[model samples]
Target: MSFIESHLGDARQRRRLITGIRESLRELGLHLSLLNRQVSSRLELKDIDVDCLDLIDRHGPISPSALARSAGLHPATLTGILDRLERGGWVARERDPSDRRAVLVQALRTRNSELYGLYAGMSTSMNQICDGYSDAELQVIADFLTRSAQAGRAAADDLTSG
Candidate 1:
């Protein structure tokens, strides 16, 4: 039998690897959440604000309505959140040139760099570790991360749909 066929027959081996990956991903996610909370505390912001900030960082120059939809937040809640963020100088609302009726919320890039500084050591270490992988292996790792995030979002949607 080929190596692929042999591995396919070994369900226990696959299960072990899957279990290990799942547990590690869970722990890593918790640790990152804790780290984000730490940064939020240092910035005198709440966990929800940190979450919204991350969303803005990922999807900013984004409309508040779009952000609310992406984040599953109500308009009123998002308004209060955006107000605090703007008042704190963490974000800015700008006229959307394409849509005269809309204002886009954008991350204050320079202000965000201060938060990134808190994660510099972790970022450097992760980059060094990623560097150990070959190009193909890194591609596989990237694919796994992308799929994992998709799965996570789908699962969250499932849980909240009811």
Candidate 2:
């Protein structure tokens, strides 16, 4: 039987498990978001701005439209965030070689290294928190999270389309 089906055999137990899962998901999301905001605020960036930075880091020299799409942000809003990053010397906009009309934004070399260092430190701390879990357990947790995120995205799409 499926994991969910197995866990949801009894109505009362299923209700309790579902409630606990929902509460944990909510608390984890809020805590992580708030923690990221606090850390980024110290570096003079808002949560959205930090997300923009992360997108750039993941896909360097990407177009503004592509960045906005990946970040789930509007093009106009992303333009504003890029403007701030540019002014802060964290990123640079260059003319796209293939398309003169399009601009490709990339993180500055020095800035990229600094950001990578910060990410490494944060990752280390996060990993430490899960160090008690066995590798198999972590893998299971990752799989569950991936499936949950996929479902959540589908639901969001349905809502928006409807």
Candidate 3:
């Protein structure tokens, strides 16, 4: 059975599990956002700059439209972020090889070692934490986090639409 499917809990059990998960996710988000803000400030960048640059690093050679959608920024806002990053030598905007009309943004990896180092400590700690979990347990954790993020996004969309 799939990870989620294997949890054949009753309704109350499921509800309790979901409540705990949501609380944990919220706390996690809050803590990470705080940390990110601190790091971004130290790097002399606005929070959105770090956010956009991180997105580009994760999905570089990525089209502006997709980045805008993923970042939840308006296209004009994304263009401004791209302009700032390009000017700072943090990112590069290039023409899409497959689509001349499209612009792709990529992180200038060599220019951002300090940014990467700032997260290394936390990443290492998380890796050590995960080392305590067995493969199946890790799979369950991964699946739960993934579903929780999707649910959170869906809820946010619902709120914005109404």
The most accurate candidate by TM-score is 1
Off by over 4 Å in 2: 1-11, 112-122, 155-162
Quote each prediction's TM-score: 0.89, 0.77, 0.83
User: Considering lDDT, which of the candidate structures 1 and 2 is the better prediction for this target?
Assistant: 1
RMSD to true structure for each model, in Å = 2.9, 4.5, 5.6
Expressed as tens digits, the lDDT of each residue in 1-162 for candidate 2 is 988777667777878898999999999889878867876877698789888887787798899998877777779988899998899888899999999998999987777665656567768987897898999999998999999989987886676557
- Highest-scoring model, lDDT: 1
lDDT of 1 at 67: 89
Tell me how far the alpha carbon of residue 95 in candidate 1 is from the true structure, in angstroms, after superposition: 2.1
lDDT ranking from best to worst? 1, 3, 2
lDDT score, residue 46, model 3? Answer: 84
**Candidate 2, position 73, lDDT:** 74
Residue 104 CA displacement from its true place in model 2, Å = 1.7
Give me candidate 1's TM-score against the actual structure: 0.89
- For model 1, residues 1-162, the per-residue Cα lDDT tens digits are 999888887987889999999999999999999988888898888888888888999998899998887787888999999999999999999999998888999999778678889888889999999989999999999999999999988887787686
Give lDDT for model 2.
0.83
Candidate lDDT (C-alpha), each: 0.90, 0.83, 0.86
TM-score of 2: 0.77
